[model samples]
Target chain A: MVVGFAIVAAWELVTAAGVIGFRRPIYNALALVGNMLGLAVLFLMLNAQFLFAAQVIVYAGAVMVLFVFIIALMNPESDVTLGPARGSEWMYGIVFGLIFAALLGVLLVNQGLTGRSGPFTPEVINAVGNVQSVGTALYTTFLFPVEVTSVLLLIAAVGAVYLAMRRIR
Target chain B: MPVPAYTFLLLSGALFTMGAIGFLVRRNPLVVFMCIELMLNAVNLAFAAISRYLNSLDGVVFAFLVITVAAAEVVVGIAIIVQVYRAGRQMDVDGLDLMKE
Candidate 1:
């Protein structure tokens, strides 16, 4: 398990860096696809079978396809130049990243996982099935949020159509 | 023994930091959006890890919801980006400052 985790972790980091470091938008999109796939594998390792599926289908499959399609359609130019005024922006970005990482490290080291354990242990989940338990919880405990999310999705769909239609008209 | 939860959290934090840096440093708006997705994925990783460690399904469900929201956001955002591109606007986030005036 340790070796597997290490391999996946390395893959995740490399692909993530690719997503950010690639000059071309298409390459960035492709790198994100790889990163999402690595994340899906991690979800599986964490015993989140449903999340693994969702991450694969939704993120790697649907979302990345959209990104690649848009990149193809727009054919955006690679960011070759830093521009005259914005050249130093990356230095600030690096500094901010260092500080943010340091804070997270301190928090993780100081205060570890302190949350109360719940009822769904691995044995229980295995008996009930991972997807079944998650679905029941979603409908029972999280029904309201699920309904709201559906409404939000509907609104987003309508908004997207409206935005696209305006250009046609 | 199984992998520790803190390791997962650490990886998530690193990925989030990278995404934040990319969001700030990248000039292209599309890349910025990609960085946002990276950050969201990192959060999802933490959620799943914590959920497993805590023996709860809440984090998994929450991660699922986040995936849904991200999909919706991407659809709308990409549509807007396409519109902007069609309008002949520059693709750089720094250059698109029409609202400032």
Candidate 2:
């Protein structure tokens, strides 16, 4: 838990403060990759074995690849600078972020959002296996959402292609 | 002893807030995109924590869907960013005001 928290803290610092350097977004991407890997471990601790694998494969692997590719395409040396935030913007970001954190922290301390623990306890997960249990629930109760997810992916692909394509003369 | 779910939730909140701050403060489109992903990851962590605490598989399923959607979002968002960069030769979010007279 401590290690994971540290990794996440480092990720936020590098991404938000540009601890390595402001111009090097590659380092930020790497930090994100590390953060994702840490989250995967946290998922494992939660008995979300399937999600752990998926997070590693999808977020840490594929999504990060896209980010790195775009960052590289931006011309590493020439357009590295993405412009610094102005004084007021920094102040706003800090104020909003701190307020958000404080509010959520208070809520957690007050036990406001802790829902009743359900049926899939650690014992149940061990008995049925994490992957099988998640697959069962996903296909049975959540089938419609699965279909919507596929359609969303299709639309995103088409939109990306359309945006990237040059207009025909 | 196993860590409490609230601990994970708190970390998630921290991450989400940090991402929001980055989104508000960063001028680069790509960094902004990364910040958005960071927020999504925070949500995933929270989902997993709640799902575990609730003793249901639903949270994992939701997080799975979120990861998939985020992948799609990255594809399209980066495409748009690339297009904008091609046109303006700048990655600054303010400089993207193509509608300015």
Candidate 3:
């Protein structure tokens, strides 16, 4: 568990500090892939086996590949760096982040893992299986949203093709 | 024993803050997108932690939806970026103001 947290912390540090990504966006993209893999392990630790597999297959495999491909295609030799943030804008951002963190800490301390048991207990999942339970719930209770997601994906594909296509008279 | 839920929550908060800082500091549009992904992953961690703590599957399901939506959003966003790059040969977010007179 601590190892997982350590991985996230180190990865966040590398990306946040722009250490590896000062000149190359590909490094940051790869770091994101590593972070995604770590999150998959965390999903497994949480007993979200199906989510773990999905995170690996979808996020680590597909999404990161897409990101790396884009970064490479955009400008392989060009150095990509952002201008340093000017003035007190960053100070404000830091203050806001600290306030948000404090709020989360307070909420977590007061709640402290209080949760009601649902249908997908460990034994229930063992009996009906994780994939089946998720699929059942997705198709039955969340059917509309599932269909909407499919539509969203289709629209995204069409929109991407249209946007990236060369203009033709 | 597994890690405490509060630990996961705190970690989520920290990751989200880091992502926010990255988003603020980065000028490269691609890096900004990556920061957004980091924020999304942080939220996913929180959802999984809550689901595990509550013995409920709802949080996991929502996280799954978040992942799916993120995939779609990335497709559209990167396409727009590619289009802008092809048009201007510039990747800086500040230079993307095509409509400014």
Candidate 4:
């Protein structure tokens, strides 16, 4: 819990204070990677060891590397491109704010969002909701989706390679 | 007093919102990419918390898979960003609309 708060607070403070310019994509990306590691620790607290490993290996490690790579490659100095949406979004933001407030109000009144406590014994792996159980459930009940995940990933991979491929001059 | 899972979730929620707003409001491709990463990390926080509550390991594993996917996203996104910048001179989303007209 402390770790979670520390990470979030650090980021919120840093960004809010403009200690590092928010427009600096590198800092934002770096902060994002740090945030992912902090969340991985949070996962450990949740007793999701496998998830923690995945988070560290995949998100903090791999995905972030890719994000950095993209940042380096994108060349932020290209001709001025997308317009800042800042001025125009205020009206829509009010609607979003109201919706967020309404949702939080409902959640607070019902207590469903904050009130859940799991009967999470330390040895929950044997009790239930472990990797094996999830695998069994996925293969049995959610087999189609499991297979589809691969298909979608493959499609994405192919598309990426194709898109990134050099054009034949 | 020690913080709680709800606090993490709330913080995660706030970070995610920032990312979303940045993605929408920031004109730079890099910022948009960073925003997307922020949202993904928010989901990771939720998964971790729920996994802990459920006393299950699968959620973390799933989160790992998500991380892997994120890595892949970086490779491709960077490649495209490079290509786009090479062809043009900027990283704004609007600059790539040569296909539309």
- In the order shown, the candidates' Cα RMSDs to the true structure are 1.6, 2.9, 2.9, 4.4
- Name the docking class for model 2: medium
- Displacement of the residue B52 alpha carbon in candidate 2, Å: 0.6
How high is each candidate's interface RMSD, in Å?
1.8, 3.1, 3.0, 4.3
Give lDDT tens digits, candidate 1, residues A93-148.
88989898888879677656888999999889989898999999999999999999
Best by lDDT: 1
Measured by C-alpha RMSD in angstroms, how accurate is candidate 1?
Answer: 1.6
DockQ of 1: 0.72
**Least accurate 10 contiguous residues by lDDT in model 2 chain B:** B1-10
State the lDDT of candidate 2 residue by residue for A43-149, as single tens digits. 87777889999999999899998888877778533223544445686798879977997888696777644577688888988898888888888899999999999
The ten-residue window of minimal lDDT in model 4 chain B covers B52-61
As for DockQ, the candidate ahead, 1 or 4, is: 1
Best by TM-score: 1
Please give the lDDT score for candidate 1: 0.91
Q: Give lDDT tens digits, candidate 4, residues A1-169.
A: 5766676567653552231235566676777777667666666666666666777877777777766776675546422234544465545545554565565455445532443455445565656545565566457756675676677678778877887677521
TM-score of 3: 0.88
**Model 4: residue B35 alpha-carbon error in angstroms:** 0.3
For candidate 3, the chain B TM-score comes to 0.94
Segments of candidate 3 deviating more than 4 angstroms: A1-23, A76-89, A166-169
Instruction: Estimate, for each residue in B1-101, the C-alpha lDDT of model 2 and write its tens digit.
Output: 24666677777887788788878877777878888998999899999988888888888889999999999999998887787777755667777776674
| lDDT, residue B64, candidate 4 | 52
In model 2, the runs with Cα more than 4 Å from the true position are A1-22, A76-85, A112-114, A167-169, B99-101
| Candidates 2 and 3 compared by TM-score, better number | 2
Q: DockQ for each of the predicted structures, in order?
A: 0.72, 0.60, 0.58, 0.41
